[model samples]
Target: MSSPEKDEIVVQGIAASQGIAYGQIFLFVRSEVEIPTYQVDPAKRIDEVARFDRALVMTRQQIARIKAEVEKNIGPEEAAIFDAHLMVLEDQALIGETIRAFESTGNNIETCFNLVSQRYIKAFSEIDDEYLRERAGDLRDVTQRVLQNLLGQTENALNRLADQRIVVSHEISPSDSATLDRSATLAIVTDSGSKTSHAVIVARSMKVPAVVGVRNLTQRVKSGDWAIVDGYDGIVILNPTESTLFRYGKVQERKKSFESRLLEANREPAITKDGVSVTLMANIEKADEVGIVKNFFAQGVGLFRTEFLFMNAARMPSEQEQFVAYKSAAAALAPQPVIIRTLDIGGDKPLSLQADLFPKEDNPFMGFRAIRFCLEHQDIFKDQLRAILMASAHGKVRIMYPMISGSEEMARANAVLAECMTELKQRGQPFDENIEVGAMIEIPSAAATIDLLAPDCAFFSIGTNDLIQYLLAIDRVNDRIAHLYEPTHPAVLRTLQHIVEEAHKHGIPVSVCGEMAGDPVFSPLLLGLGVDALSMSPAWIPSVKYLVRAMTMAEARALAAEALTLGSPKEIYARCDAFYRARVKMD
Candidate 1:
């Protein structure tokens, strides 16, 4: 791993919680923040205000250019996420709020910016919706620039770190994640979030290794501490020896080779050696994701995160608007089944109008969220259901309820759905009654009651992330207790096994859309548990799909049986690795 050092050999602390990635360095300095100033020189103040506004316009143009260039350089969908980020650049609420704070208080630009950005960011962070939570980061990134510009600084006047710096921060704010150019960023090191946070999402989207929630990341790794980040296991190493570097260098190469092959895997079908075909689908959020699905040749959109529709809308979105969104998705995927989850917004999703929806609770995890809200508020629930039913007429749509407890809850939910259908029929509104209805087996109670629920629903989507959380009583997002939240745990595996078997016994298909579904090591285990389909991130499609084709039904079953007999989570992981590596080559 030791090579001849150039003039400035840039070595950084890698937050390799995602894995090691080797690519050309792309350096990016965040746009300067604009501070609001009031000099009382009305003429001069107005002119400067105009100038600041003009500069803001130019900054927006620059963001648009970067977005298009990144999209053109990479892929459209990758760029589209940034493009969506750019939308906040032109947002009126953000702009008004930032400037208003300065106008109202005589606070300097930094104070105003600190106040305004923090206010909105806190609000966004409190939102339960995953997609909307990202917007807070977007706003933070832009607002920082606005404040910097207002302070009359041309650049972020922090200490000079490196020509190619991997940011080692206490926490990677969404703003930091958005503004960093992946080409310049060696990797990201932070002390916050599990795999589902903005840091992990950005790293994965950019194919960079990000280690988040390291207790003392900034303090432990000094300036220019030669470090290595293992994103695969969320490990950050400082001042690694030559031996470790050499090992990581090879690991990086092997990882690259494997990823390249997964891209090529899309061209081939997921067929077993004996020729059994497995359906592979991508879980998507934005409407633009449909293109990625087509590009990857995905069988269909397995999970369409409908939460995007509810984000940024005033009040409830009309049934027609919801219908159009679902219809467009259904028509885009055409014969392929679109499992439309009915607004999985709760806990952290920020709904501007629904302050009452998010009641103060001791535990937000077990609080009034998901289907509980639907049961309490029929109008909103019916609005979403009506939209789904209408979309069903356009193409195959499967309606899914999140956080189902038992048959009674599901039956009550369906009762409303039936009323919606009846109303549609009475109005001569065309919709598909054959649209499948299902529940998310994320709650442990739901897993226990799967037998009672199977006969009432069309299918079951086992959301492993939450199931593991509820089963083990550990929050995946909390760093302190995340170690306890292992998906391969005996209790968790048994739950997955029971639900999958119960669903199959009643001739119902059970699919998994959680993180475990995307893991190559767990694919065989899932199939062994009798999972019919796996819906994961669009990027993971080819790898998991390829894995599906390599193992046989008998092999999968044997692996599953062995996993059941395992006593420890570590043993389960070892067994999964050995089982898959023995046959599939782990690309």
Candidate 2:
């Protein structure tokens, strides 16, 4: 009988980062910080509060050091992850609530702070937005550090690894991930995490292979177990057999070769063999990400998510603050258009600052969100428009409104933009008077009525993520029905074609600024459908550009035409996948 060491055990997880690694596992299990709970004497309660303050100060310093190290090692974009952590540290709501909890419960400061922090963590975790929900990890990480400092316990950090090995953990926080030694850390395997988690973001920046949500991976393997991590497929094979190792060795070579090809192609323009040029742009959340946009060779910012500025703040950002942030990205990529999206709050993204304004609803996605929220709250809308307009004076900035259902909504949003332009003029503020306005065609109604709305817009960007979700009536966050949210569904393809056609008829260029735009498999079909541009996460630009450079417009158009005739989404996707695989030469 073969021993357990000879037996191959494979675990499947979500591929958080791309690469391959084979090394001994360094099972990094951090014991939970045990909080001491007891009633504090009335006289010493003030002392407990002071103890909390001291802990906060120490935690802030620790995060600052980590941020500085990350900035030095990785680029400033990755360092911005810690900025959110620092914001959490300085949040008045969290601090005030901790004090209130202590005052009300008369519990030990550690216990009170933990209770208040847990409430905040729970609230964030429950948020429908994936990005916002991932923030719960940041909050949890910060809270644990504060509790540890208050209790005078040192953290179990992965900064000082004995050797290069795969770091296996239940979850790695941004703070812990920041301190990870690149030379000593071979790869990261987490039992719980998502692609959007800050830890995963750090892993990607460090160029380390990472597979997350591996169930109870930590429980199964010892620290010395040898493992093969396939980040491409999100697979981890523990105690791999000789045959399995050989097979994976070949897979690694092919993947590395393909990645090299992608990078080589990324340096070139995204032009088809038929001489048709496609503008490849990036979707950025923060101004700090301008560096990443340039690094990936994205032509411009197709989608600048303004909601992140609000999400990171304790209160609504002032117009001047918003202008400075917008201007930073605009000026950095001067002459390269920065398409600033208006506030897309509601649905999954709710403002903690104005919770009363967005009451819980049965279906928040269709309720008050994006353009509807902006139209109703014109005060907020004008502030953002004014900022975007002001930033345009510094660089090539364009404004786009999200979730426009029809022409009426487009007109209403444009009216607000006009008011901002007028206000800026009265104040003698410099702005691009001809700063173009665009509408996002994410809603099914917007897709159907693009002809009516296109006249009021300078350009159209298809937000396939939400469009597919609404088209299929699928709650993308719902694990049970998420698989039903198919981008290649006949209805989705038809809608996309209709939207592009309608926009073209009105002489407005159309671009896709969604997950579908980045995927190599779907990109050819989109380009074939006559989209003028594609915008996605900066990292994905290279892969999409590679595919574009490999294929001709004639072939892409043929693929799209054939796909339209196919009745099954699987069939359509298979066709697209075949087209991508043939040109990519990964096999």
Candidate 3:
């Protein structure tokens, strides 16, 4: 996949993040493993079991250490994958099966353990689902660690990345990625991985530019080779020519210039030239990301995804654990409201504790997920509710529910929340009794019922990421149809206009907290539609603010008027692109 011009080779891959980086290539070559097999005496079978138990303890401790490191450097959601590895190590079925084999066959600990692990890995690999099949990678990861311990192999390849370079690797294990030096790593170019891999998720949360699934990426480049990672376009240039380097260097400088403008915009109000005001906020995954909110000068957290608490543990998080996390974020942004979205799990996000509860489905996106899962599992739902309520007393915290299809789902969710409040009241825990509750308008039915749903809630937050997907019946994550997921489609605009119109009618404010909210090109259109607020990743706040400060309500309204008259996404996109170029001078 590389170009014929060796010094100017261009390779394409999946764009895991958005940015540009230029640096020397630092190939992360992993050491190979060779497991040895030997026979054990019949009387020494018990000793083989002891050896296996020791390896398990060592691997668990190692994974915990890596988890803590990743949580500190990256975020808790990325670190949570290690919890699955720990679970695999502690699986009673796996360990018991291995012990039985060792005792019956008089085989060595390595042989018995490898045989049992392979069976489990093979079973998961055979699953038809992509997500379930990915679990096979986890099994292999844990088993490799145990085998490495039994083989006395303690070397690590990612320990010395203190020299700044773009990390080039064939395949990076999550455990190894945790050990990478953030200061030294400018970007990442991997030879193999999909968008769903945890390694890509880690790179994204760290704000590092990355391009994965670059076939033969490692084979074509050597250490110290000049590389340009066009993460915005998912291109990796190895041994880039002088002209190519010069071109990207200017692009990088322009990007820096735009970022400088965003920084300057931080001090400005998110107000239109015509004196219209719009609130700008951040969508955070963990409490630690509150620092980013403050740094970007976000008004508050519009969507604090509380699912991280459930995802980080092997089982349901205790009310106390959940309270501590929610309270920290809310308290950090005191006076400013932090709207915590509770338990948006199921579908893609399966809990390790309740994997058996949800079977495979043909269409998980439309299946039992989000609010549907919460209402069905009230115990898990209530525990999170109690925590959110308890945390509300510490600061201005609000509760929001995701994937609400209609008034019935919202009513059932409100019922469970009320029950939690009653239980908390009996326990005499102080909380904001008047904390506001909101609903996310993601599904078309929810948008259609905004009039009914809005009156019951204090506000509305449109989850445009999923709304656009569901509206178009396109899975944005599926690269095959990702091109069809258009945010600027006429139908999407009309739907958003409907929701906003309905919310304003009920005297409730509506905010967009999805990818559209962060994009500068769509900013004018959204403002024209009269959305009260926009919430996005913390990094987008400043740029969006800059764009917000430039336009007048009259101009934005005119743009929206024209955009609404358009028939196709292509036409709408062309208009927006022209408007953005004129506004930002990005090119």
Candidate 4:
């Protein structure tokens, strides 16, 4: 009997990467490994432990090979995805837990390791932050690889693909994504994933279309089935009709043309039609990403998240190590301001190497995180400050603190900076004593008291991501209430206006460095509200720059004025969207 005929199906998911692809589905499934469990005799326990050690060595070598290949095929930034994998391998806490489990229970090494790793995976997966929650996938990937190596199983399904096809899976791990053949893989589709997942990072780096979080997509489609992957709008069409294909071909052409126009406009300065210049900057995680910053024609670095330096390492980076990293970015973008945000760890971004430092909290976001964590751990905070000071000697460098609730927190942070400066001076270190310091206005108290906080700070950067979340009291990652976390809400808009007005009163310029800042739709509204600069991911700069160049400041202000009068978020957003669409011709 033949397989039953299936009708066309359309599935919606999160758009992980932009582009379009139409090809036969290659359902790449890796079944869960069946581990053999057996009791280990006391004498043979040592031998079992030794066997486990060798398996770790083998897993390390395999990951190293994959990392090297990824570095060669893609760029270093994308290859940095594997850095987390290597960190997992070297994690003493995880390794020690596995050993303890085996010694206590006398179970096989595989069972002990599996139990420990699964516990960790569960913890990370339950995290409230999307970026951190995706890390669970990293743990899952490494665990499976180690288990397979111990069982002497070699599965390289992705590498063995003989033809180009749309790769679909339940969840594509970082290791599996790194090994993907760019020439043979048409696009990547997953039943579960997010834009922040390592696999999605690889897909974006490869410029391959990817649609993720399509619930039960793997079960819906099978191998050899035809599908249209619309990564732009996060729609996947199975068994697309000839008419649908024709329509999409034209849509693809239009999208490519629009992207080209955005790039072309990016090469020019971000000046409005009325000759008002806007400072467009990039938010970077690592020093190596300075190349991308310049490539996107950004004026400078707005938010250099220093927590990545800690999160990626097996231990806290020394002052000298951090100095080198900060200096590289400063020097690379010399003459351009590099605003380094001090360690914003805790909550979603936990340091596995120093796990004991942070205790579990019911609500880590508003709990002992960011400025609170730094103030209590003054030693760690001072080291980062000194490094930023040293890097300032090389090029333009400024410091910004995250989650400052009010002036008292700002004063405490500044007092520590003063201590670092005094120590640097005593050591005969040449540094920028007049280096500017800024505070992130994310907390409601900080925003409410901007007038009080502005006097102590040189600048202010509105962290709209957190600000909106706190202002609306909605968990952004929660799908059910995420819609309630609206930036266009009257309260959010009014608060932003108040911040800008107050910051300007004290002669301090304010910039927005959040998801909203990068969006072209919101850029004009922010500028109209008197924001001095916009900082966002480098890739998004082109489109935002294009929008800035397209309209006049007067028009932006008029749009903002109209939006402020609107009663509901839907109405306000509609007005903003119309303003953007009117200025930028998409059709």
- The top-ranked prediction according to TM-score is 4
lDDT of each prediction vs. the true structure? 0.71, 0.89, 0.82, 0.90
lDDT by residue for model 4 (1-587), tens: 11236567789999889999998999998789999999999989889999999999999999999999999999888888888888889888889889999999999999999999997787677665567689889889999999998899985557768788999999998988998888989899999889889988999999999999898999888899998999888999998877788998999999889888988888999999999999999998889999999999899999998887886576788999999999999999999999999999876566677778888877877888899999999999999999999999999999999999999999999999999999999999989999999999998999999999977899999999999999999998787888798899999999999999999999999999988999889999999999999999899999898888889999999988888888899998988888888888755
Using TM-score as the yardstick, the better of models 1 and 2 is 2
Off by over 4 Å in 3: 1-9, 12-49, 60-143, 154-156, 160-165, 181-186, 191-209, 213-226, 231-233
Q: Which stretches of candidate 4 lie above 4 Å from their native place?
A: 1-6, 126-129
Per-candidate TM equals 0.81, 0.95, 0.83, 0.96
Judge candidate 1 against the unseen true structure and give its global Cα lDDT, from 0 to 1. 0.71
Which candidate achieves the best lDDT against the true structure?
4
TM-score-better candidate, 2 vs 3: 2
TM-score of 4: 0.96
Please give the distance, in angstroms, between residue 446's alpha carbon in candidate 2 and its true position after superposition. Answer: 1.5
Best to worst by lDDT, what's the order? Answer: 4, 2, 3, 1
Q: Tens-digit lDDT track for model 2 on 1-587?
A: 11354668888999999999998999998889987789999999889888999999999999988888889999787888888888888788788888998899899988888887887787677665577789889989999999999999997688889989999999998888988988999999999888899878988988899999898999998888899998999999988877787888899999999898888878998888889889999999999889889999999999999999987787889999999999999999998999999999875566756666786777777888888888989899888899889999999999999999999989988888888889989999999999999988899988999889977999999998889989999988777898798999999999999988888988999999989999999999999999999999999999999888889999999999999999999999999999998998886
As for lDDT, the candidate ahead, 2 or 3, is: 2
The backbone clash count of each candidate, in order, is: 35, 0, 0, 0
